[model samples]
Target: MHTERSAAAADRHVGDVDLTHWRSRAGRRIAGAWAALGKRYGAMPLLLLTLAVGVGIAVLATWIASEVYDAVREADDVAVLDRPVLDWALTLRSPTGDRLVTWWTDIAGTIGMPIVALGFLVGFTVQRRAWTPLVLLVAASGGSLLMTIAGKDLIGRARPPLSDAVPPYESSPSFPSGHTLNATVIVGTIVYLLLLRQSRVVTRVWTIVVGTLFVLSVGASRVFLGHHWLTDVLAAWALGLAWLALVITAHRLYLTALHRGAEPEPGALGRS
Candidate 1:
């Protein structure tokens, strides 16, 4: 009985070792295959990876936005808070506050946001002499505009009644707040570009803080001015963030590919 037990124990130990060894060998084979593919294809693999991730982000955003749209259409869940929030905003209104918010909000208006983005793009192009800022701005703005137009047209959500709105009332469909979405994308992209050039912790922190404040204030202004419901602004925030993530991810992947393909500088090797 003792001899039989020892034989069984040895067999179990041998099986465990063989399993681990097989796993190690399989892992090495997979790694070797990936390395060989990378060498042969250069940056194509990175580009393909970026494209896959971008598509996933877009699909996820679309799914979430659709859920919000359905809820709004059904007037349940988040849609229930719209009227209460709008009523609260109505109570806080004043001539001075309206004027101030209108002025600030206009800075992110359809016309205003494009102008601001263009000015920044030109300045960054001249300063950095690179097309990255332009690419980021265009991608961010274009995607934001497309999503805004599509959401508004598809949802066709009505804005607050004209009686409740501030002067110079908007006539467009107001499901996803265009002002809020544009502000988020443009401001976010600009901050991202700036951070790429900025190394100081304090400066980066301030940049992020200011950018966040600008986005929040714009979304709030839309509600306060009676141009959009709370849910519209919320949807715009989520959609804008999704688009921004896609842009940043693509940019990061591009940079990774560039760095991976570049040769080492003289005397730089082994220094790090």
Candidate 2:
């Protein structure tokens, strides 16, 4: 009877060991699957590549724009559309027209203010992170302002004559419009952030519509207020667009990295 009991005990011990081995093997397989998925679809590397290309394009556009601006300033009646464009921009001055133009500009400019507010709101509403979009927006605004100042200092292009009734506080070169650049940055970033958050198509459509109206109104206001030449507004629009592209590229990379469990890169906030 004692010999039989010993053999039964040995058999039970063997079965327990087998069960432990099988469970260990299954756990490793599960861990390997997760690692493989991460390796295949992470967004970090793509973000880095996009940022490099965007910065390159912005530099090229700014350089070419400066050269073209200088050439036009020196020539008499060059292939420039300064006066004609300005005239078109300013025709909305009949009593009713003035009201319409004023209303649009005010309304459009107001749309950008919420972005500043939204930056703070993000901390409460989304991630509870304060420094993210706020830092980016501030950086974009400062970069635009600095570029405007530098361009004005280098070119020193004159405004139209006294008959044109230049805008109050207008000074320096008529090459790039600062107001337009500011408008673009403020409106552009807001639209970008909103698109990322919203799921409904209608929300995205409204965001785009508001952003477009804001940018156009700000650029047009510069001409209407006689603060910038038509070319100035055009250049600012182009330059601002280029700046915005770089900013967006950087933001995309940051977001991609973020999605990939990486930290957001410095200088990806749109500063030069």
Candidate 3:
């Protein structure tokens, strides 16, 4: 009886070991997958390429738009997208709309993006997880800033002919709007981050919906407030979307790198 009991206990011990081994193997696989994804999306070369391409496109577009401005200077109605829908959007002025526009533009330009970049740094340090998101964020913002200044100087297109309320700030180039670009970066970054963390369809839908609304609102506000022309806003959106695509591509590269055991640096995306 004693021998039989000992044999049964030995069998149970072996089973437990097998179960633990399987669990460990599964955990490692999951970790490996996550690491791979990060590396694939967050590599330095990939991100740099993305930034280069985006800046290059911005330069090209700005130059072309400047040519258009020169040719169309004599036209009284020179707006490209002059639909009533957009015009109505331009005229949507309420005290609340004005306040919201001012608030979002101020926050996005000044604090919101910086804070988000900081959060990515903090999270990366604490969690030792993905850090590529932050890198792309910094690249987008810094590149956008450089491109904006150069474009403004080069293009020098005046703001839209204002018939309604005048902007508090001096209007510069009417080809690409800084406010619109910043809005897209801030909101687009938010959307990309959400895609990273949320896998559920419903959750992603909500995130995208809310994010889109916010971005569009900010862009529209600039036009409505007479701060930017319709073409300027549209150009900004196009440039911002292209930059965002690059970021997403970089993110995928980071994921692949993570799988290869290469850890990314903190604050990769927090360039101010």
Candidate 4:
């Protein structure tokens, strides 16, 4: 009886070892198959997903901007606040404050903002020895410019009267403030790109906070300087966010395609 029991126990131990070894092999094979499947069929799905997200953002932003336009055109309830906001902004103005705000707001003007964006692009491109950064910057800033032009021309909303505004007046259509929109897109994009390389928590936090403050300050400066109505800045913020979403979505798809072993596009981010 002892001899028979010893043989059975030995057989059971061997069987247990075999089972564990089989399980380990099966797990590795499953993981390999999954990775292979992703490499084979992931690009198209990623492209489709990004397209859906971009379209959704564009549609929502357009709808919101249209609603604001209609309100302004019809002098609806929201439009009524425009005058009061401008009046209040005007009340806050003084010689020193005007100079400071004007100086700050100019940093986001057509010439100034482009210079700022170009500097960032050049610096990043040189540091990484890559053109992806430049490509992304161009796509973001170019789209923003086109959107600003279309919005301003479409709405043809005039700026607040010069009498109510500070000196160095603008004559452009003011439904969407170009300065605010451009600043938001450029600064926000820079922050997004910066965060990709940053691992430290403190650095990431400061990047986000500073970027947010810059965008908000640019928008507020537009109102305080009398270059745009309150609604103009609001609409610009909405539109800028939408464009930024589209840009980031495209970048993500690019990265996903590269990960799946798809042929890389020219100037795609190698480090990403």
TM-score of each: 0.76, 0.64, 0.66, 0.76
Stretches of candidate 2 exceeding 4 Å from the true structure: 1-61, 75-79, 88-91, 95-130, 166-169, 263-272
Q: Per-residue CA lDDT of candidate 3, range 38-112, in tens?
A: 455544554466457766776676567666655665573555453443567655677887777777666455476
Residues 73-160 of candidate 1: C-alpha lDDT, one tens digit per residue: 6767765789999999999999999999999999999778888999999987665544455656876787787778778877788899
Q: TM-score for model 1?
A: 0.76
lDDT per residue (tens digit) for residues 48-167 in model 4: 445455645554565567666776568676557788999899889999999999999999997889999989998876655555567568878877777787777777888999998998
Against the true structure, candidate 2 reaches a TM-score of 0.64
Model 3, clash count? 32
Give per-residue lDDT, candidate 4, residue 28.
49
State the C-alpha lDDT per candidate. 0.71, 0.56, 0.58, 0.71
Collision count of model 1: 0
- Which clashing pairs does model 1 show? none
Per-residue lDDT tens digits for candidate 2, residues 1-272, read: 12211211222222123211224565446334422433454333443344445545655666677787777767954335777776675665465765565555554343545555465446423432223455456556655666676667666777765455332344567767766766776678667655655567787888889888878877887677566677877888888877876776455434433433433333232322
Residue 6 lDDT in candidate 1: 23
Worst 10 residues of 1 by lDDT: 1-10
Span of ten consecutive residues with least summed lDDT in model 2: 1-10
Sorted by lDDT (best first), the order is 4, 1, 3, 2
